[model samples]
Target chain A: MTENSDTLGATEKEIMYATHHAMVKSGYAELSISRISDELDKAKSTIYHYYDSKDALLLDFLRFSIDRFESTVNTTIGAHPKGDLDHIILTLLPCQLKKEKRQLHCVLVNIMPHALDQEAFREQFTEIDNRLKTIIEKTVRRGVRTNVFRDVDPAQAAEHILAVIKGAMCTRLTTNREAATARARTSLFSYIDSHLMA
Target chain B: MTENSDTLGATEKEIMYATHHAMVKSGYAELSISRISDELDKAKSTIYHYYDSKDALLLDFLRFSIDRFESTVNTTIGAHPKGDLDHIILTLLPCQLKKEKRQLHCVLVNIMPHALDQEAFREQFTEIDNRLKTIIEKTVRRGVRTNVFRDVDPAQAAEHILAVIKGAMCTRLTTNREAATARARTSLFSYIDSHLMA
Candidate 1:
């Protein structure tokens, strides 16, 4: 068994990758592990050995998603000078540049309520939400201090921005990507310009 | 069977009502029909008779929700003058005054994606989305023609407004209602006023 496990090659990796993608796209609630096993032409026990349960697999997928999002946003925002709220927001909010980010947005909007209802997942979700909120709040506060943004409440503004970004991404998930991108960018910039202090 | 159904009476109605509330709060994907039946102290068959499948049951709940929201918005907006966009927007957006509207907002934000995946439910969801968008577009066009709004693309602006309203409602669903209401109203009015002709 150890030798077989050692020889488990690219096919096993492909199977797990496919399972994760399917789960993210359709949701874990609707996903069937047996179907995933069948798709991979792997034994159920082998799949079970890789993931203790569907919930465990979902958690892994979510962790990967959260990390990727945090890193992407960090890289995009960090590329610009600090306190450039418009640049930071423009980079993060639009769904055109990154497919993974859009998928993450869909999962976030669709899976969050169910995730919140689960006792084990509640704290993890709360932490992630707060972390994202904190990043936006900090940027808004910086903009206010620099007179780039009006004297709006940073926390409230951050929440609103996040909501709009999420909503725009949700719209894109079901509509034409190019059109959604254009509309989202225009609307977001118009909003920022209108809201910012002269 | 008809006599037995008649005998079931208000009890079944009460059970369905409770289940509907629970489904809205938790979402149809996560709702437990068995638990709902247990709570009602009724056989699952009784519930099944009224709702042939979970999809049917959820669709019924959604239909009830759509009717309630449409009526509430129509009545609230009708009470004001004919071309008052701000009044119409304020009345239509989910807030504390209309608890049912808030619940419907939750259902839309949480369940619409799952409904989109179901063939039977997709048309209904699309109809509701298109109907709401058309109404807003018509109002924006009226506002522009009356010289109340600036020379903007009415369809794009209408979609943006819908995005913001829906975004705000999604925020309200996940956070404190009072704060969410205050922020949504402020942002909404600000957006509308900024676009109006001076």
Candidate 2:
């Protein structure tokens, strides 16, 4: 057993990234310290030196990954200053890396069951979810005020947008049908173009 | 340790219903044959007599529940001749049993992680999900044909509607906030009323 630390330094960040990559490769069910070490090319003992158990490492890893992911979204949102709403919506989408990889959002969803058991993860997830929705709410409100969008409640519009993304992602995750997923995604934007626009 | 039966009879349906009630009460994690037996006021042997184990019974119960639930939705759809689109959309909404009880849909979602392991459950769930979505697709197409809806692609529009419903249900499941859930649900209908209408 080792002492659990609250914050991650440079080395800790590397370890968390290793854990995430390992989780992405195999999934959270088979995630282990040994595997994380293998991914990072670190000895198992050295990896265990910073964390007491798999659970502790995973909890911290979830927090770290979520923080990093949120910051990236914030950066994307910030980059598009008064840009097209479609591009902003596109920025929030989960993407496939290649024939091999997917975005971290998909990986997080794969371990959703595990997160349900962690009180801290649930609280953090709720907050992160709300913040993400808030960004959309602001965007929608801005669109409405600028006469780009119809008179719609920003919060409800935000909720619907999130739902569309979630539902589309779930469809893709389950079916792995690119065409069907694309249709779902495209339909959302078209709905926005037709309905949400003033 | 025992033979797995292929079909369930009336008694078996009753037993499955008991298992569902028990699941709704204690959730999937705490669900057991003994708990189901207690719920039904039957001996454990009685349950074991029909099914080999909890997993087998649950698989069957999921199939049974899906069948029954689809029938109810189909019944609701059939009851509406020249039905309003809002009524059609309302037919697909998830329900709460009472102030204290939620419908079994939430229970199914609670066990979603477990379903990933079972190929039967995954297949059945996917098929059932597609069928439910198909109902919405047909409704949207009918609306478009009758000039009640905009000329939207039926499949894509269906996907968006299902996504909204799924996203809203997921929110309700996670937040348990009545106001937020209602807002999410209402937004979808309003979106249709405003955008889908010709």
Candidate 3:
């Protein structure tokens, strides 16, 4: 195996991937180590060896999810025109409509309640949220400078945007994902256009 | 005991009450019949007599929480004039700021992830959410007719309002409850005012 591959062995990676799949399928509350081990054809001890406890396993999976989300957003933005704020928002949101992304969001929101209960998890989740908020804030500020967005407070606008995205995620998880995504994009674009400075 | 009192004996009430307390203190995931029985100094069978299973017990608690939320919102609105939409929105939000209301929200949001996994729970939760959305939509429409709100689509506005409330709840659960609650209320009211006809 390559050096990088040896650092994160196939078994460990498989375990993390399996856990993520299980969480997305059944939710965090219903996930069990035994089920994961059964799927991986590994003993429970092996899973425990990789992760001290179920919480540890979950925390690792959440961290991985956040990292993947950040990368995906960044890559999508990087591949497009840098200063197209509307395009950036439009592109990033539709990604949520994808099967994998939707599942990831399900797992994220599902774990949120428990995450709030754990100090470490709460801090980590908040950190990720703040980072995302900062990105949106910066984007909105850029839009304002270019007269693409109105002179509203960037922080507040960012919060509103985030709220819409989160709400859309919840609605999508419960109902038709395609319809919810379409509505969210339409509503969001309308809000942006209406609020933008001519 | 009176006939009405005899129907729900002291022990049954004690078990239910204890279960509620346990959910508030430790969350729904930590709740179990044995734990409730232990807390109430009753036998497991005695607790089972009141609830068929842990799922049923939790479902009852969830229903109770939803009812309390609905009643609180209604009561808050009723305390003011019928057409005073501003007062209604402002009054209803602060009720969520209270400790008890926040706890109930915690439980509600927490169970959403598992809703898909549990058919009965999902149906109950969906009904509650739909009812809440309807109430908001009706209030917004009334505000529009009375010139208290702008000519914006009532359904969209209602959904946005619900989104803000859910976002605020998540923020409160993840961070400082008081601060999140205050900020959420202020932002929501401001958005409403900004959109209303001058």
**Segments in model 1 whose C-alpha atoms lie over 4 Å from true places:** A1-64, A77-102, A119-128, A147-153, A174-181, B1-52, B60-64, B76-103, B175-181
Q: Worst lDDT window (10 residues) for model 2 chain A? A: A94-103
**Which stretches in model 2 have alpha-carbon errors above 4 Å?**
A1-14, A37-56, A77-84, A91-103, A114-119, A175-179, B1-7, B37-54, B78-84, B88-103, B114-119, B176-179
User: Candidate 3, residues A1-198: lDDT per residue as tens digits?
Assistant: 002222457788889787877766665666899878866777999998888888777776766666667656554443222244555456456744676666777777677776657876786667566656667777777767766666777777777766666666566565332444565556666566555444
Of the true interface contacts, the fraction found in model 1 is 0.17
Write candidate 2's Cα lDDT for B1-198 as tens digits: 112223678779779878878877787667888999999888999999998987778777767776666666666544322364466556555444352234465555555554444566566557656766777788788878878788878888777887777666655555323465567667887777776777
Let me know the TM-score candidate 3 reaches against the reference structure: 0.79
What digit string (tens of lDDT, one per residue) describes model 3 on residues B94-177? Answer: 644566555666777767776745666766656665666677778777777776666778777666666666665576676433
Q: List the residue pairs that clash in candidate 1.
A: none
Given candidate 1, what's the lDDT at residue A33? Answer: 78
Query: Which portions of model 3 miss their true places by more than 4 Å?
Result: A1-15, A21-31, A34-47, A76-96, A174-185, A196-198, B1-18, B25-29, B35-43, B76-96, B175-182
Using alpha carbons, what is the TM-score of model 1?
0.68
Q: What ranking emerges by DockQ with the best candidate at the front?
A: 2, 3, 1
Q: Give the C-alpha lDDT of model 1.
A: 0.60
Name every residue pair that clashes in candidate 3. none
Candidate 2's chain A scores what TM-score?
Answer: 0.79
Worst 10 residues of 3 chain B by lDDT: B1-10
